[model samples]
Target: MGSVFHGDITVGYEDEGSGEALVLVHGHPFDRSMWHPQTEHFSRAGWRVIAPDLRGYGDSTAVPGTTPLAAFARDLAGLLDHLGIERCVLGGLSMGGQIVMECYRLFPERIRGLVFADTFASAETADGKAARYAMAERLLREGMDGYAHEVLAKMISPATIAARPDVAAHVLRMMTATPPEGAAAALRGRAERPDYTGLLSRVTVPALVVVGAEDAYTPVGDALDIHERVPDSRLTVIEQAAHMPNLEQPDTFNAALGAFLDALP
Candidate 1:
């Protein structure tokens, strides 16, 4: 684990392995630890794997004010610059996927390929925005205990929770440990993110879109939309998984990701 200073915010990340660079971004409320499965696998397979805790999560500094998703994108770009990586494959899950799209919008030349997992390109609807704000308020008042329980079923399949108690517990711990201020800021900021459907059609690089078959938030349909719109893209659906397929079904997810990396120039 290492730390980098990006203005007032300090970002924490894990850097491992060697060869072609591959940066993996974690989703909202979770930290870089979530990518342990992919990081170790890909690094051993001859690729540099970087997993960073976003500004408000894990060991990174927390911002009190509203943090636009674009801010997260810029932090990623800065991290690449700090490491002297001119261009590398960028992969992200959930909110991290949205952040990758924002990075593409800001610095397309810096991306070699894209891995979008369990995410969508559409903007938040009115109802969705309202819900996010409501959640934010609830978190500020009540903390993460209730929210963690509410989201657990939607995050992983029932079979996963039953079969892998450790993984389920890890997920809960990650959520509960997240700073309320930071999580709330993210929720509010996400409400203002731009629609990336148009951007998806413009992506020309090799892209892989993966989703859990049972993903409730961004379903398989969302992955198909991304694959169909992106000029050079493939879609893979992991069975018996939900939102966090990479964690729920690591072997399958890593296999698909490895194939994508191998195909990339």
Candidate 2:
């Protein structure tokens, strides 16, 4: 674990291995630790893996006020600059995928490739926005205690919960540990993210889209839509997994990711 000061905020990150860089962003309510499997795997395969706790999630600074989703992207750009990386493949899961899209919008030149995992490319619908706002309010009012368990079924497959108690426990711990303010800020910010459908059509780099076969949040159809729009992209679906496939099925997720990284220019 290391720390870099991106302006006033101190972004906590884990940097490992060497060679080509691969920056993996964690999803909503989860910290950089969520990428432990990918970080170790890819780093061992001769890639520099950097995973950061987006401001509010991990040890990173929390937002005192509402923060735009783009702020997370800007923080990423700053982290790359801090590391003197000119360009690299950028990957994100769930909300992290949205952040990667924002990063591509703001610093296209800095992104050599893209990876979208269990995520979507559309803006939040009117109903979705309302739901997000409601969630934010609920988190603020009740915190993450029971709320983490409430969403665990949707985040991971039923098989995982029944067969892998350790994994289930880890996911719950990550979610429950998240600060309410940070989670709320992220929820509100995500509600306002721009539609990335048009942006996907313009992606020229080698792209990989991976989704759990049973992801309820984004769903397989959403991943297909993204794959259809992005010209140079391949899609992989990990069976028996849900939203967090990388955690639930690390070996399969890493296999798909490894092939993508190997084929990159």
Candidate 3:
């Protein structure tokens, strides 16, 4: 279902279905496999599903720089071009969201739709970004385990993590596996990223906004903010879920995401 290939360094991705092409991008500390539910459902619904493990994360090579998002965007665009896709729907979670924004900016004409799940356009600016960068640097240098544990606690709802140790462990392992430098650099880039609030207002494409009701990282409030800014953007909040609503409430998440893709023109 998936293969590892070179794109700004060797990267891996999974492809499925056979209709309108839709690309799924995973967040940091995880691989494309994270989109299992949504991708499966959308594929069955008749849309081509493409999920790629961005460079420097998952089983791929690491990108050493401050602007990894640019490379990530290029990878998505290149993948589509390589597949001979004239246009495609762009979807992402967290860092994946950042990548989509960059991709849209870089290749606006190729984007047919937008899906943002548990993510937001950058909010920090200037010196405020410095603090976030410093925090990431500290974590990279000496806080991998602790950072992983902290992320685990916040990423999944307390009930989910407490009920499923296996899932919790898998997520933590992914977070821990992220190259510290890569993670730090990626975070720093996101922290200092340009405000896309203005960009959202200009988005002529239909958009889908989804988030975990209990997501502490990018909560429902953040999702609402995006919904308000983007034109014709529909918002869906998945209950009993945290940052990873897709993993925690797969059925609901899949249903909502599939509906969005299906409704797309």
Q: What lDDT score belongs to each candidate, Candidate 1 first?
A: 0.93, 0.93, 0.81
Candidate 3 Cα misplacement greater than 4 A, ranges: 1-8, 126-128
- Order of the predicted models by lDDT, top scorer first: 1, 2, 3
Question: Mind giving the per-residue lDDT tens digits that candidate 2 earns over 1-265?
Answer: 8999888899999999999999999998899999999999989999999999999889999875566778999999899999988999999999999999999999899999999999999999999999999999999999998889899999999999999999899999999999999999999999999999999999989999999999999999999999999999999999999999999999999999999998988
After aligning candidate 2 to the native by TM-score, how far in Å is the CA of 70 from where it should be?
A: 0.8
lDDT by residue for model 1 (43-101), tens: 99999998999988998988866789999999998999888889999999999999999
**Where does the lowest 10-residue lDDT sum fall in candidate 2?**
61-70
Q: Which whole-number lDDT from 0 to 100 does residue 5 have in model 1? A: 90
Task: List where candidate 1 sits over 4 angstroms from the true fold.
Answer: none
Q: Can you rank all candidates by TM-score, best first?
A: 1, 2, 3
Q: Cα lDDT of model 3 overall?
A: 0.81
Q: Which residue pairs in model 1 clash with each other?
A: none
**Candidate 1 lDDT score at position 190:** 91
Error of 2 at 204 (Å): 0.9
Angstrom error of the Cα, residue 229, model 2: value is 0.2
